[model samples]
Target chain A: MLPVRAGIGLRHPHHREFLERQPPIGFVEVHSENFFGDGGRDLDVLGRVRADHAVSLHGVGLSLGRADGVDPAHLQRLARLVARIEPAVVSDHLCWGAIGDAHWNDLLPLPMTPAALDVVATAVSRVQDTLRRPILVENVSAYVQPDLADAMPEAEFVAQLVARTGCGLLLDLNNVYVNALNHGFDAQTAIDAMPAVAVRELHLAGHFVGPDCVIDHHGDRVCDAVWALHARFVAQHGARPTLIEWDTDLPTLDVLLEEAAHAQRILDRTRESVDA
Target chain B: MRDALAHWQRAFGAAIDGAATLPALRGDAATVARRFGVYRNNVRLARMAALRNAYPVIAALVGDAFFDGLARRFASTYASTAGDLNAYGAAFDAFLAAFEPAQALPYLPDVARLERAVHVAWSAADSAPFDVARLASLDAAAQAALRFTVRPGAHALVSRWPIAAIWNAHQPDAPHGFDFDAASPPYFALVRRDATRVRVDTLDAAAHALFVASAGGAPLADALDAVVAAAPHADAGVVLGTALRDGWFDDAPAG
Candidate 1:
């Protein structure tokens, strides 16, 4: 089981830092495809980190909502990695990134309709079958929300996904907040309708604040509003394995650890309430 | 419905692939265009950063602004078929080789190719080190017939320019040691993974010839013969000793 505590996203810049010091944190999460190569320094670094920390493999390029089935080669590479690491939690976005052979290399959101839901559910089942274990699918921050003719709400679509595939939800609260601002949805209400028990992990990340749009850039400190949303979700659904994700324009290791510590405090408070 | 999805996918691809025009999304065109611009920028910026990461020396050589422009152009022209961003720009070297604006810097393509090799060497599959003791045990005849397998992703690329010298000069951490030979000698870059880091070193002519031949699956005698054919002054024993000491080849049965 994934630990009900705080963790930080392990990125390339901090690999050397992690090698030199074991900071106070519950676990470390890494982008799964970074280690897709046969065997090399990144894999070696991951193995070393695994020895000391419970690792979560967060993937970005799975493209689970594609009309076609998931790519067999990408699935095989992911399976090999899961076998090698036996990570505490494995997760990918609930977004379609590629269309056939062209991979955008960015998580593109799915339409909140039955068709997209079926596509994602089928792909999630395929992934679970391949790994012989359930995986968490994260909600993505999207600029354009598809106004499909027969659209279900995002929460209902995700809940249906969980019900059909037996996979858990990686409720990215930051995405919820981002979407709320972008699409004029109530963030709390959307999250409140999710299958709470099926949420296996939570993601906290910083977003870029633009005048016209809020971008999920993961480059800055987590804003207060995202934290507030995360707090409400923890209060309602209980604590899961929460992660602090920082991608580009990375600060020093100490700054990342500082964010992780803030998350740790939240987890502790949430756990106390659950126990009480 | 599947075709509809594919159509939308293609439109989405067009929207993000450096096109200013909006695809026919299901929302208000004006609103959708403003919002969708975010995704377009995301795709362009993310892929640009990936290329920038993979080819830091090239980016440094061309300056940041020119590199960004080059990246945007590459992103527009090529579709990254692979899911991994690291694997996205396999065509970049070839793209640079024929790119019009970059024609001013003729050697940039080889430099791009070298950086890609170094990037590949960094994450290449690990192979067992060459066991030199096995070479001592073999009979002279069998030794000559012995084909060697080098560490994975280990090979030399022969270039018409002083590519190694140029690459070294561009590297932020590389020492200012290698002389930019005025003769503009063709360079052979030996790419190999040592411990946790990938090292791209300039090999002498004899060593380069041997690596080029052996990396292509030539036997020891054949590799030496190629070296002799290429340069009669090449010292076969010294180069062999150098390769062995560098853990270039794993002593395994030729399959």
Candidate 2:
């Protein structure tokens, strides 16, 4: 089982640190595509890191929310990696990234319509079948929720997905905060709509405050508002295995650990209250 | 894919691919339309970043602005079918070969091809070394008929320009006293990835002929004959010794 504590996303910069000295964190999550090579230097690096700590395979390329079927080859590759690594957690975002055969190679938004939900649910079910294990699907930050036909808000769509597909939710708090800010919705309300039991993990990442929208760049330090939201989130939803995701312009490993330490404080506080 | 999603993707793709207007989204039309630029810029940049990471030497050869422009153009022209972005730019060498903008740098395409091979070799499948003892135990006549397989991470490349020198010159620890512009004989590149580091060696004509032939599953005697025929003055012993050190041969076929 994944520990109910905080960990940082593993990037190339801190690989030496992890290999030489294991960090005091629960587990390290990696973008699965980076080590997707059949057998190579990158996989070797992953192997070394996996030995010292628990590893989570977080996928960015699966396009689980696409309307079309999941690519069998992609599934095959992912299955091979999963079989080899045996990660504590396996996940992809709750977003569509492909249209026809062309993959934008980015986490893209799906309309909150019934049709979109059907497409996403079907895709998730297919992936679950392929892996023969339940996978966590995270919410994505969208600049523009496309104009489309009937349905509910994004939260409702995701909540229904957990029920329909039996996949756990990787509730990305930053995405919720960014989406609420971009589309003028209450972030707490969105979180409230989610089924708490289904939320097995939480992602806390920094965003770039762009001119028009807050871009989920995963660069820099997490903002105060998001941290506050996380504190509130843990108090209400109860703590899960939260991850501090810092991608671009990565700081020193110590800096990442400090961020992880911050989340750990929140987790401990939440756990203490439950015990009390 | 449904009709609505497909239609949105068409407009969204066009908008990101070009200066086309953003597709109408569910929210405030004007605000959301303006905000869509983030995704547009991101998709374009993300694709460019993947290519840049794969072809760093090419990017270094061309300045940042030049590389960025080239990458963007490549991203716009080619639709990435693979879910993995790392596999998206496989056709970049071919694309660069025909690219009119880079016509001035004729050697650039070949360099790109060499770089792509290096990138691929880094992740190629693992292969055990050839059992030299088994080969030595065999009769000379038996050895003559034995076919050899190249290591999975090995790729052979031939280019007119000193591609190896150029690639090495750009390395952080480029050796002292090596000249990139000096005229030299054509070189055959033996690119191989052994565990951590990937090396690209410029092989002599004889070694190239012998190894290339051997890598393609040529029998021992025939391969040596090809090397002697290609360059009669070539040292046969040196060629064989180099091949052994380079982990070139998987002599024993899989049982």
Candidate 3:
């Protein structure tokens, strides 16, 4: 498969534009939960796009962090979708979104404990087994770091997940950037400690600067610092399939493509450097 | 480990309720509270945003402040049961019906019902229209005896207010000065996706009666008779023809 040069996180607002004029980009990704229904217009549109573009299924609602066994029904739905779409890459956040039956519908952090690690590892294995394919787990931006997680740093937690499940990592550089500022850690250090061999893909997105810290809102262009971090990531990991995600208050397709093109240029430069 | 998981779940729930912070398990109390606070905020924001997106008309009808408050209340009470937020607000219509603040807006429940229908129809399922050729191949007797099922994407909604008109008026291209009279008689609306577009049509009394009967498994002839009885001058041929053209039926004749 051609490497994921640069893709955009497809949103509903841009559906008409995408359908009308198939924009030039490396690939496109979508939130898996948005298409979880038995059948509907959403499925119809997705089917139309699947024929034209290399699509990726990036799930946001799997709640993989919940201690309860993964929801069998959700797994079955995702399995059916994967069978239907046969996306290039299937991914979900490395965060939990539910507790028992009550789903929070947000990516919640799991404490970095041996017990939590065991639970998360088991969940990933089960999901991979059911889907009959290896899945990539992406690190999410954190607003608060739990006390219990002190025993294990974020990088170690990610490395352990990759070790246990043999799943690839979608290192979201912007998330690391956001968390670094919010939690007062060095972003590059975190990236350096990650198991580079397992890093199969990278994510670049815009974030909002809040009063106390930055939030990974994915609503703007890639910041100077995040782009710098992306350059550093490519230096170590080579040119992986990098996705440019812009979720809230999305700009026109042209703007998003421009942002992606910038990433592509950086990737090309990094490839040259590595070749030398 | 299970005990810790349970405590975490409880603490998270309490945090949403503003009853307690995430308890310090292996770190400082302030850090735990702040970190856990992020999860709590995310849960509330995501669910609320989904509700707003699904019920934009409802949000517009009720001002932003009112809608946000209602959304918060619904989130705290229901707590999303499904991992998919697309299926999050299944109970919002009923909740709105009983909400004291919304009681004055009598048409609010119907609007909520319509919004839910749109959401369901949007994600219900992809289906090809019942093959016209198959229906034509059936003899007159077979056609009369045929029992058809609506595909998963099919939806039928009945409202006591002019909800269809109200819903259309809220669309992006709607004209100004569109007002609904609360005293208008109940309206029956049918929504189904031809493919990607949700087509909402208003059903006359006769067509509505026939559909409701057929949906309950009545035979075609009986349903026609019922339609004729309800509206003596109603054209059964026109109604059935429109339904067929709209791909409402999912099958032809059963052997």
Query: Which runs in model 3 stand beyond 4 Å of their true positions?
Result: A1-4, B25-36, B131-136, B175-184, B252-255
Instruction: Give the per-residue Cα lDDT of candidate 1 at B219.
Output: 83
Model 3 residue A206 lDDT score: 90
For candidate 2, lDDT tens digit of each residue in B156-181? 88888888877887777887546654
Superposed Cα deviation of residue A167, candidate 1 (Å): 0.3
lDDT of 1 by residue, A139-217 (tens): 8998887654677877888888988999998999898999889888888888888888999999999998787778888
- Per-residue lDDT tens digits for candidate 1, residues B1-255, read 555555666677777875676555555777778878888788888788889988998898789999999998887777778788889787788989888989998888888888888888888887777778888998999889888888887857788887777777777687766776667577778778876777778887888888878878888899999888878997898889999999888645663
What are the per-residue Cα lDDT tens digits for candidate 3 across B85-140? Answer: 87888889899999998999988988898888887887776667778788788888
Alpha carbon lDDT at B83, candidate 3: 84
Q: Please tell me which predicted candidate would have the highest lDDT against the true structure.
A: 1
* lDDT for position B175 in model 3: 93
Sorted by lDDT (best first), the order is 1, 2, 3
Q: How good is model 2 by TM-score?
A: 0.95
Q: Score candidate 2 by DockQ.
A: 0.65
Which portions of model 1 show Cα errors greater than 4 Å? B18-27
lDDT of each: 0.84, 0.83, 0.80
